[model samples]
Target chain A: MTGHPQSSMPGQKISIQASQLGKTYEHPAGSVVALRDLSFQVHAGEFFCVLGPSGCGKSTLLHLLSGLESPSTGAVTIKPTSVGMVFQEHALFPWMTLERNLSFILDQQAPAQQAANRQLARRWLQKVGLEKFQHAYPHQVSGGMRQRAAVARSFAVQPALLLMDEPFVHLDYQTRMQLQQMLLTLWQEVGCSVVFVTHDIEEAVLLADRLMIMSRHPGTAKTVLQNDLPRPRHLLDLKTNARFIDLVEQSIGVIRDELQAVD
Target chain B: MRMKDFAIRTLAPLGAFLLWELCSRSGLLDARFFPPPSIILYHLIMISPGEGIFRDIGASLSRIVLGYSAGCGAGIATGMVMGLSRRTRDLLYPLVAMLYPIPKIAVLPLIMLIFGIGEMSKIMVVFIGSFFLVLINTLHGVVGIARIHHQVARVYRISRRAYLRHVVLPGAAPAIFAGLKLAIGYSLVIVVAAEFSGADAGIGYLIWQSWETFSLKSMYAGLFVIALLGALFAYALEWLERRLIPWRDDRDTREHHDA
Candidate 1:
């Protein structure tokens, strides 16, 4: 049932490669080691989740991949193409209208496509159920709505690799579930590589094709686990599916052990 | 409730005026110094457009516009330079900090010597008054821009010109407008005081001339006009500010939703 063309290939194309990535932040008090000698690869059209506890550098890995920050000691390689990011903060330009926020990224097209790009923006906003709020400012919307807008904005860019740092972490459970499904649907439609960072084990299980778990205190990708949960998995179906529960429990067990080891 | 709010708002000033009128009419207060609101209004009308009041107002406005525009232009430019470039900020910030607190009135004697007690001197005084206020506020605004904004811009690979145009300018606008508001009030005060030191035509000159001749009523009229001008200036700035910061009022909605 996997109709995703890129993933259908037996030898999946490596879209992103990180090698010995390290980040150390220096403050007045002392130095803080964020990520140490981290390395990973994300396949084309893959939903790759980076799972870890807080300060375990899941976000640092996203940053390095997105080139939002330079690694202190390593390199990341990506197939030359457009990239989009949905930060935990949403980072929607508050001064702009929602339509304008999406257009700011979308409207970077040829003069002929300018009108089409705008229409595309409206279509994407409609997909996120924000068509009516296209003119509203960021502060005028609810947190869930703003996150949806942020998600819509990122997807509107039609990026080759979409890096998201727990975009739904701040939403309520119902909102989070709804957004997660919306994101998965959009991901399948776009077929772009995603490197989503989150701390929630259930979220990781729900969304990822495979997930990397990072160990705390001088963080490193401790393990990479595969999720063989069947495709087109409904949100409610995951609750009763034994394999889904097993995957979540396995991830939680590993994380718990890592937390204990760190202490 | 709305009507009551309006009534309450209107009555405070009206009540004060009535008490002042009673005090003056009953001879309980000195009319020479503390004239009733009616006597001040009568003198105000007598010195309206046909009289020298319009000329004084026009002269004061021209000086303010000229001085305030020059100062704001210079301040915003230099402040942006200081904000974006550390070298410039390091070089100029100390000097600005040292000079910012020195009253423009204190420099009037020196300015008069350089610009020679003419319109240039008065304008210079007003310029100095506004320049520091705008420069400091604009610098603070730019420096206070969130790191996340820069990260977002970089991640998007936005052009330097576009970043400045879209992000920096709008981000700094609220603080810049605040500075402008303060500058306008400061310019008004400085221009008036500068006129008093030496000027032939201005509200400050009118007030000074009236005081010298013991024309209490005209002095009160000049004061009233200046007060009105101040209110108008403040109201205009606030109106402009509201237009620039469209997100400000929406913050109430966000906070309400949060609660």
Candidate 2:
């Protein structure tokens, strides 16, 4: 358990550390365990991937890490900074326009000036290539555009650790790849630690600096694989890169073994 | 296309009214009971300062304004409180449930006895009717907001006041508008009914007195006025709803709900 958040070992370049973390939801029939003794560390400025199958509590882990839900057991320590998250559903406030969504977060994170936030929100939208659709409501635009705005809103705050829960799972193949590249570019620019959870091995392998593979049924980290692929990885370049292919295959094997062990 | 649509809408209703007038004038319909439109129009045109028609309309409208405002205000406040806190919902929900189902008109006799045959009695009936409708809808609006939205607010560190203003209020607005619209029609009905029994100074009284005095044209005139008022109120509320919630789309994906 953590004694104090800031007084912890943040000086050691650990962006976030979760030790002996577990979560059990209390229901009418019985209590369902979602996470069990899941321990991991995301270093400062690292792209950490939590790869697991559906129902493996990858989302619950993200929730726990983001301080949305408290762990039933153990503790999560992080350098105190406003955390930003992207959900599978985009989770942009549907009522708010694209610009307002970014500005809403900016207002809370950077309470400088209204005009400054407006300019910053516009800049963020421009970065996501959504400047033209700044006044458009979430449903007014296409799904990809909405997700991009969501991404912009998350990054607008300039978070210390960004948590993504299968953020591109709903997009079409082309959009998904395009967004994956966009995410890499943004991550490269911001240099923030990211804990991305996804079921797709290829996506995890493509994005993660270190992939943490989780076993199913009350998810626990089975193994953590280091991605030795070279930096500034383009999706097109990654396709021909033998190391990328190898990492995907390696992560797939680990996931397959995890699924097999349970059966 | 828009002009054609407007023409069609206006012409269809005009055609029906014309047919009714023709039928009544041609002796196919009873003019005594179902008076022709032209005579009702004449009676409406004849309305003036001395005729007490304006006073009746004024009496009815003031009751609606006072009661509906207070009722909707109380309902929304209570609903928002209940929506945000489970403890408040647990405490107030059953009380609301028990109280809401009882028809306000049914309590007219009781209210008249307590509040007396005055403005308070009339206004109170409308208030009760409006309060329940708005409260329930506002509660549904708040509770129905996606769990993910709440999580978004927390994860982004949205302050409680800001969350309520930006999320909860707007989130519940469509449903609250639905409730407000229902309450308008209900308020009109309750006011008219309350006036029917105890008052001598409303559209209801005008209609009732005209009937007793065998002034069928005036009675028809009262009915016509009520119809016009109903349309006016509905349109006003609809306009307000459109202004407040610009993103109320029928075809919006279910994943992202009402603003």
For candidate 2, write residues B1-259 as lDDT tens digits. 9999779878976898899999999998988888889888888878523568889999999999999999999989888999999999999899999999998888999998999999999999999999999999999999989888898999988888889999999888888999999999999988888888678799998888888999888788888888889989999999898888987664456436422
Candidate 1 Cα misplacement greater than 4 A, ranges: A1-10, A109-112, A261-263, B1-11, B47-51
What TM-score would every model get versus the actual structure? 0.94, 0.94
Chain A vs native chain A, TM-score per candidate: 0.92, 0.93
- For model 2, the superposed segments whose C-alpha errors exceed 4 Å read A1-12, A258-263, B47-50, B249-259
Model 1, residue B8: distance off in Å is: 5.4
Best-performing candidate as measured by DockQ: 1
Q: Please give the lDDT score for candidate 2.
A: 0.87
User: How does model 1 score by TM-score?
Assistant: 0.94
Error of 1 at B171 (Å): 1.3
Clashing pairs in 1: none
State in Å the error of residue B242, model 2.
1.1
TM-score of the A chain in candidate 1: the value is 0.92
lDDT by residue for model 1 over B1-259, one digit each (tens)?
Answer: 9999779978977898899999998899988788998988987896555558889988999999999999999888888889999999999999999999998999999998998988999888888888899999999889988887787787777778878988888888888988999999999999888888679999999889889988888888888888889988998988888987887665765778764
Give the lowest summed-lDDT range of ten residues in model 2 chain B.
B250-259
Model 1 chain B: lowest-lDDT 10 consecutive positions = B250-259
Clashing pairs in 2: B170-B259
